[model samples]
Target chain A: MTHFEPISPLSVLDPRDRGGPVQPLLTIQGLKKYFHSAGNSWFGAQSVVRAVDDISFVIHKGETLGVVGESGCGKSTTARLLMHLIKPDQGEIIFDGEKVGIDIPLTEFRRQVQMVFQDSYASLNPRLTIEDTISFGPRIHGMYESKARLISHDLLARVGLDPSRFAGRYPHELSGGQRQRINIARALAFNPRLLILDEAVSALDKSVEAQVLNLLQDLKEDFGLTYLFISHDLNVVRYMVDRVMVMYLGSIAEIGDGETVFSTPVHPYTKALLASMPSMDPDQPTREAPLSGDPPNPINPPSGCRFHPRCIMAEAACSQKRPALETTRHKKSMAACLLQNRDTPIPFPPIKVSGQ
Target chain B: MTPNQALETQPVIARSPGYWHGVIKRFSRNHVAMGALIVILGLILMAVFAAYIAPADPIKGSMLRRLKPIGTPGFPLGADELGRDMLSRLIYGARLSLLMGLSPVPIAFVIGSLLGITAGYVGGLTNSLIMRTIDVFYAFPSVLLAVALSGALGAGLTNALISITLVFIPPITRVAESVTTQVRGLDYIDAARASGASSYTIIRVHILGNVLGPIFVYATGLVSVSMILASGLSFLGLGVRPPDPEWGLMLNTLRTAIYTQPLVAALPGAMIFLTSIAFNIVADGLRGAMDVKS
Candidate 1:
């Protein structure tokens, strides 16, 4: 197996290199994933589901990048691609300074970067106990039984579930939130630099969600880890991530520093997402919430912009021009929208930089 | 090497007592299975100690005492047409009956499970090829297939064992492949892959444990069918040549005695029925215990 630089360039912590365009630890260049949808009947036809349609982004070292989108918007697909769980058809992912596909085996990449799934209960092997679940990767990767067990106990405690009480228990014995905590400990077992949470805490109650979020923050700081946090809850993303990327049907709609994107969303879909958050105001009207119609079948997306059909502020140009992500004035983040780049009837300021 | 990979390697912890204990507890709860298990175990011991258990030499016959009634002097279950001790022969028959019934199950289970798990995991072309081959075998009625195989192979103990083993492989493979396919798509399997476990390790540790339970229960159900088939082959004179104390062969030899000693003629058939029933009940109990839904 060829060696790529570790997913996190630990050497990049030099004091002299403090302030420049943050050299992203992981760079995903125009990744695309398409699934061939099989026909239902004997004589049926087949078509492609463009799951991750030529999307690209960077994950800065030690920063949590949140991915927010509707149910089928491909946020999880992007996470899967980054982890090498699924191969991307049309792009490359470069980690640290080395390109992943060129030198690294998928297994090697997995050691540096790991994932925690959405359904915590489903994610764990029911046949294995908390200790084995946490120690499985380390054992497979060649950790000693005693050492892995010791580390597992420490991690279990770190994740806020007492190791003595929980380590011997099986997955089914635990509550959803407890199982998710165990999931976090197991993901951490391999000492990955980047951890992808694909709606990890989404299955828990609100109270449980906050506690897990807090635990995650502590673990991140303690280990100096980077994260790809995917969720549908805009509020959770705002609280947990340093920057946020909002997707609309297999493409990025808007992305920026989390606070700025949440405050002033450049793309109409992002704006709609922010408005849709359940509000304290008793009189907040239905029209304010943007998501209504089911996502158009990905096998045959709309003419140009995939989100055009559901985009409330969409104009004739929106359906004709396939907007590419462009640099906004803030410079760190980008968005893809006709309104972001030209003078139109829309209230948002006209763009000087065109979305390619 | 990665740091985690560089660490001292160790084997996974052994399965805990609770795991097997739980399965045993669940199995024990099924009263019919428990009863069947006891009867089968007892029969197995009888087969193991057939020499000590049988009162007389099984094949030795006295022309002087032919067709004697049950509870006749010095013969607990009396004598058959050749005056062979019915009780001794039936006791001796347990060994052959069980050898035919029990032996083929494990052989089929191992072969069928390997084929099934392989086809299921590899999928697409491999799956279709193996499963279709099994389907062709399945197209023949199992009894006809066993009889044909035994006849073609030239009947005897080894031929009968081979026939019964071959007859079971197709359906067991079909069940194994389907269950394995279902398990391969489960989230935990994907999680294992993402954790960098090799394909072999994943299949062994993750997939095999889950699939084994269902495959075993199905294989257990095959035992009864195999025993009956073996006896059928012997009754047809294709298995155990005459003078062997096999249940079916004994039945074939005692056919003329039915009118004079009706109960004696029925003994071998009763043994076949009871053995098969014992297997069927145990299999049913195992199915209930292994079921994930319960």
Candidate 2:
């Protein structure tokens, strides 16, 4: 077993010395993850699903960055990749100006970054009691068992579960909401600087979701934590995030501050996504589908802009080349679309949609 | 509502039952298993106290009393071909019989689980290498494999035990491998990995508990099969040698007297059948009790 020097207090308190406070807490550069699926025919080539295709993003300190996409759009894959739960095939992840697995060892990097899974029930070991599960990470990271136990109890209480009532209980003995609280408590046990929550509140009912969301909000403030929140629920994303990144077919279509992106989405895919949110006003029910067809098969995603087939404003030129993410009209936002890029010539005049 | 408020709203805080307590509670409810357990316990006790319980010396024999019918004076359950008391022989037989039948399983369980779990958790090339090699063992029928291995190793109790243990390992390994592969894909494993748990720690702390229950139930079911196989080896003159009072060996020695005193001749065979059935149903009961879904 290799020995790692314990992280010093100075380093933990002031980790971004090289880049100072301006450096993003975490940066993902050209992260790609492809999965091979066996082709149906006997001699056919194995197809690769580009689950997360050369995506890049930054999580600034103390901000909740929500990643919104339809099912199969690779949001969960990105979250897993960021946590290093699944190794990215081609990319670098920089944490606090130090390259993970290079300047800092993977174990040390993981200690600073933790993840909460979407399936609260499946995320917990049924055999371990709540306290055991919560304390397991700290104990493995070299904390004494007694100290770990104390921390586990403190975290359980902080997460709103009475330590005495919940600590000895198994996962099956708790409600879904209670189990999710346990998962959150376990993630906080490391006192991680960054938390990648993959649809953390999506599985709960509305009331429970609000409670967990509030708990998450409070914890983030208390811990000075940065969050990479991934979910398909647009309304929830709007409520929980300061910044939002909309994805389509394994690639980002738009990203910006929550207010601008929700009100004035620059990318056609993001426009349709925002328009598709189930209207709270019963008088303004959605009369038309947002975009047509399922997401293209990731094994062979559509050429050029992946969303061209479904984009309401797509042109013949849109299928010829992929659009790079560039600054949009809103200085804080960026959108990846041929029409949004100033250098690209629009092949045809824009057709105005009625509502816009 | 806050958790404390929710707790106050609830009727009561019932204590959650521990896993083992639940297993025992469920197992105790099974009438068939309970009966089988009693029978097995009786057999084990008989084996343990054979010396004090057997009325006559098992090995001592006389030609004059040979082939006496069951219930004959001073020789209850009749005498064997060499005039050995059948009841005394069967009581003494339980010791070696139970020993031979039960010892191979735990040894196989440990070795098989280690190999299988390694192959399953560390997948890809390592999985291919270990699993493909184990699959080769499946090419030979277990009965034939046991016979051939013991035959090659030459006749002895140790040789027979070794062959039976080898025969049991492949199936147990296959079960362990499949279960571990399933467990390795679960979210808890991913959560553990994300928490920076070493592979060894993940396997031990997360995967083992989930996989062990099914593997143990499967291993328990194999015990009866092992007993029958051990008995078969003894009957074929490959296990316990003569005058050792093993049920199978006793049956083999009493074969000629079957036509004359058929009831007495069948006593050892009856013991083997009864003991094996008891083991089998008890295993079934355990499987039912341990099933989390049930």
* Top-TM-score structure, candidate number: 2
Docking band of candidate 1: acceptable
List clash counts for every candidate, in order: 0, 0
Report the lDDT tens digits of candidate 2 across residue range A143-191.
Answer: 9988888888889878999777888788988899999999999998887
Which sections of candidate 1 miss by over 4 Å? A1-21, A38-44, A285-289, A329-332, A342-356, B1-16, B62-75, B252-262, B291-294
Candidate 1, pairs of clashing residues = none
Look at candidate 2 and give me any clashing residue pairs.
none
Q: What is the lDDT of candidate 2?
A: 0.86
Off by over 4 Å in 2: A1-18, A38-44, A341-356, B1-17, B255-260, B292-294
TM-score of chain B of each: 0.91, 0.94
- DockQ scores of the candidates: 0.30, 0.42
Candidate 1 C-alpha error for residue A145, in Å: 1.5
Candidate 1 lDDT by residue in tens digits, B274-294: 989998998888888765446
- TM-score list, all predictions: 0.89, 0.91
